[model samples]
Target chain A: MASPHANPSPRASRSNRATTVHLRLRKEIVSGHYPQGSALAEPVLAEHFHTSRAPVREALIALEREGLVSFEKTGRTRVRTIEAKDIREIMEARAALESMAAGLANRNWTAADTALIARNIDAQANVQSLAELSRLDIDLHHHVMLRSGNTRLLQLWEPLRWQYEAYLVEIFKRQAKEDYRPETDTIPSHRKLLKALSSGTPAEATQVMMEHVLFNMTWAN
Target chain B: MASPHANPSPRASRSNRATTVHLRLRKEIVSGHYPQGSALAEPVLAEHFHTSRAPVREALIALEREGLVSFEKTGRTRVRTIEAKDIREIMEARAALESMAAGLANRNWTAADTALIARNIDAQANVQSLAELSRLDIDLHHHVMLRSGNTRLLQLWEPLRWQYEAYLVEIFKRQAKEDYRPETDTIPSHRKLLKALSSGTPAEATQVMMEHVLFNMTWAN
Candidate 1:
């Protein structure tokens, strides 16, 4: 899942000030910089963003809807705590969605698609840290999702990705350095998937993709 | 595809006014009452909802993030239009998730679970109108998803449901009266699914559920 509030370059140009506030606050909440259950003071946020309380209030409400933050009437808004159950549920959902995407991509993949996937895998192989590996992993999955030509799938999957990324970041920071190594032979699976796609059997491709997602689910959990 | 905004009493009390506004607008969009690409006027909505512009504006922003609404800086917000491609992608994703949910529910269900699902299906069969039937259809799916015991699956599957519901409402409204006949025989499929779940073979349940979803997709499209 990408950051709900990452606010890529394009967003700045097209979005209003309220959206900008949403993006920044979303970043903070998902990244754990705000910490779980920590109160978000509207006046303080307004001061920090150099905007009025109205937009900040709006931003908090937006974040609340995304499951990133929560607020009580006449009370403060706070970052929602990430729980194990939440992570497990997210991973399961990812397993379903990504497996489907992989299946579609596999059935549709041309030689060019295979080459692109192979390159992504190679890039993953060179990552030195869990953080870099994590980033590459997201990019690779995104590549497959995009290649599947499933816009709704992309939208559905994106928020979960953002939450999972936050969790992974925390996990990376806490785990031993030796745990960060990328699987050296991961490219074979992508290659296999590509081969299955090239065979033009969506069923076979779906099966391979399912296994791929299950593998990630195991590791992420 | 149960209403994402369905307060259901419990959620209503827990949520603030802003949350309610967000959900009401979301419900409107998902129900297709606000047509795709229709402009949302801030003052008009505020007046209609008997709320201030602040909450209404916040609600629109939240909707934008959910892919149900869109806005440009210095322009009015509009109901987001979903294309055929969007529907296709959503259907594909739904197939994947719901199939997995079926499999999971099958593996996890007790005898009581089977009984409960059977009851839900029976309830669905009792609906008298197309609109009521649609609500029951959504409920049946929701029951299956909840029984699947995957929170992520529910979360991920919901937005797709909302969007699909919007489409279904459009199709339902257009179809001739004869086309709206309730499927009295469809309960058997639910029974079969229950039997599969009771047997604790997730794979079998998954297959059945996939077929069930595909069957609906064929007619729905």
Candidate 2:
């Protein structure tokens, strides 16, 4: 081994700032505060977020990797304006992932796992805020995927979840301002999905998840 | 936007160092030069590589994310000793992703694409060095996945590809030392895979890929 010549870098503290900046930037971009296709220069973002250029730079890279930001040809970075084709592609990947998750989750689900989902439904029913309602919807799907115990599957789905959420949140905001009720169909549809997972075999649960992801509910994309 | 208060970080040049460091360290770890579970102190690695701690740190983080390195409970970083369970899980994920890729590659492969695999087969037939042979094997799968035209699928497979390659390369090195010839099954098997993709339906190609990934060959775990 070589003699040590350098001090250890501050990975933990720096990583925390990068993560905080990443999540906050993701929210800002998803909420249309940054606006799609607008320039996201590192120094500008650093100034806006009250952070150093390093954390902002790290956040931009993470966002770009997640497909929420684009590195443009002329050396500029911008919020990605996701197209319908990209949306369709992401949805396809998400469908395969969630379908796989459902089969694995249903294989040996514990009582607590079932109760967790049932409790999520109860929360959905009592929720008044559309934002919270939409969050609960995302939370339930996340719960099922988490219950799958397939870490790789969850890891693969994670970036897509963030990218997809970026689009979904926009829709939620629009629907909220119109004072529209949360879609009545969501609760029943999720209830059906829960029933399929609980009583049906893995294959049946897989099929239901595929259908639920592909057709049961439509997103604006 | 507020006036830029800081010059943009030297992202391009610095990222190149990070990448250079990352690939070199991955090779060292995969080659067992830095044996499994050995402490990978940043200062030591930086000194050995003749670079500052920043690039070494960046490389370490990337390797950790790829599952080739582990961040220990006691705050030391080490090369991960991948367990059988982790191997099984990764193989399962690879099987599904490659199966999907095979189907998609078959759906719309071009003449160039067909020629590419054919050329790769020729190269595979002529290989003498196991390391070179192993590289070719990885290359062929990457080509097929690239032809799938599903960016997200490839993005998801990319990390697993690196990790799986790490294990496969160790086996290759061992076989080379023992004077064991490259498996006679591999060339023919790939020929079959290529043929199926060329002449069969996407579903058939997909089925062949699944079986090919799950069985057909064994590796030392």
Candidate 3:
């Protein structure tokens, strides 16, 4: 069957067994279910997925290509450690991408887009947990990216999203032990961005988005 | 085995047989060896590849996800026509990506990086056929993106590159029937971008790259 999936899913593993395995392993590695530098045994993964080693091996190789997993000289595949350098590069790449996306969104945004983000902001206004805030942030940004009407940008954003989100959640947890002050972080910046995307120029939208993504709040808001 | 091959190859098909089939079909479609809107019959492709229907089906599905091929409601799969809208969106997407790469390259470029792109530019200066020029263009841009020191950026660039290159060749063929004057198009712009990439600020790099990519000459250069 021709792939009907058009969202930000990874391009890896179009074959049935392999895609299922790839998605699961990708999620585990990105979400910290498989801790950094932990070896991924093919046999173990095969057993866990209730499949043979072939698909597991395929998925591991795919993950390695995405920078999430690394193959050591010892021939063991391990989850790559997400160091500070990794975070900087990944974050910068995301900034460039979303900034372009913001410009497109500014050009193509509709009332539906405005309404959607406005509602998301309204939800953010009531959010308490850092984790909840981060999810909302991803949703808002993803909505903008989608409404931008650029499938290519979204495809590029897919792999990076997992790494960005993992780091985002980690940073949020480390920086904010308690509920966020919604007034200071997400509310104003997102509102300003929403307004720019809805009615302002492309330059305005890109500038706001660049700042929001680059020197993003330390708390991941 | 883990994927050590990293230079802009597709994320699809880590499994051996499917990968081989996928690569060949992708090259054919992107090169227009198989004309756009040509039906990709599974049995015929399977026979031609000396493989069963399985790998060909997998490859077709993967191609569908990449937007090079579309599956109709009637269940026939064909190479999607590279329409004007597709070209514009694809080209703009490439501009945004390469512009970001240019900025990163400016900040982190090394001697080897400069040497590589310089050689590519020199080659472009002496290119003859439009086909040769298009390949050179892809080569030069790929070098710049690679030198940007961001693997994620390059990974995002991989899938888009093929589509960009495909339409680029078609556009070039239609626009210029004779040999290009290097001085008028690629030579000056590439030289300017390379110099900026080697020594200028990130903003300068991005600006020059964006112009070179956007209002790109009528030629594919």
Best by lDDT: 3
Best by DockQ: 1
Off by over 4 Å in 2: A1-14, A47-51, A72-76, A122-133, A171-192, A216-220, B1-14, B47-50, B72-76, B118-134, B171-192, B216-221
Return the interface RMSD of model 1.
4.0
For model 1, residues B57-127, the per-residue Cα lDDT tens digits are 76776677666777765456888777656677667888889988988876667777777767777776676
Model 2, A1-221: lDDT tens digits are: 13433333455533666778898988888777866678888888888877677667767766776788887655579888766577776776776678778887888777787788888988887887767776787888898888888888888788887777776666665565635354466678788889878888987887788777766335545
Instruction: List candidate 1 segments past 4 Å from native.
Output: A1-14, A27-32, A72-75, A184-191, A197-200, B1-15, B26-36, B72-74, B81-85, B123-127, B180-185
For residues B1-221, write the lDDT of model 3, one tens digit per residue: 24544333433324445678888989888877877778888899988887777667767766765677887755578887776776666766777778988998898888887788888888877887767877887888998888888887787777778777667656665676665676687778898998899889999999899889876633334
Question: What are the per-residue Cα lDDT tens digits for candidate 3 across A1-221?
Answer: 23433333434324467768888888877677876778888899999997777668767766765677877655578887776777777777778778888998898988988998999999987886867877888999888778778787786777677777767555654576765687787789999999999999998998899888876733344
Q: What is the overall TM-score of model 1 with all chains considered together?
A: 0.84
- Deviation of model 3 at A155, angstroms: 1.7
In model 3 chain A, the worst 10-residue window by lDDT is A4-13
Candidate 2 residue lDDT tens string, B74-168: 55788887655667667766766787789888988877888988898888777877677767888988988888888888888887887776776
Off by over 4 Å in 3: A1-32, A36-81, A169-176, A217-221, B1-19, B41-47, B50-77, B110-116, B171-176, B217-221
Scored by CA lDDT, what does every candidate get? 0.73, 0.75, 0.77
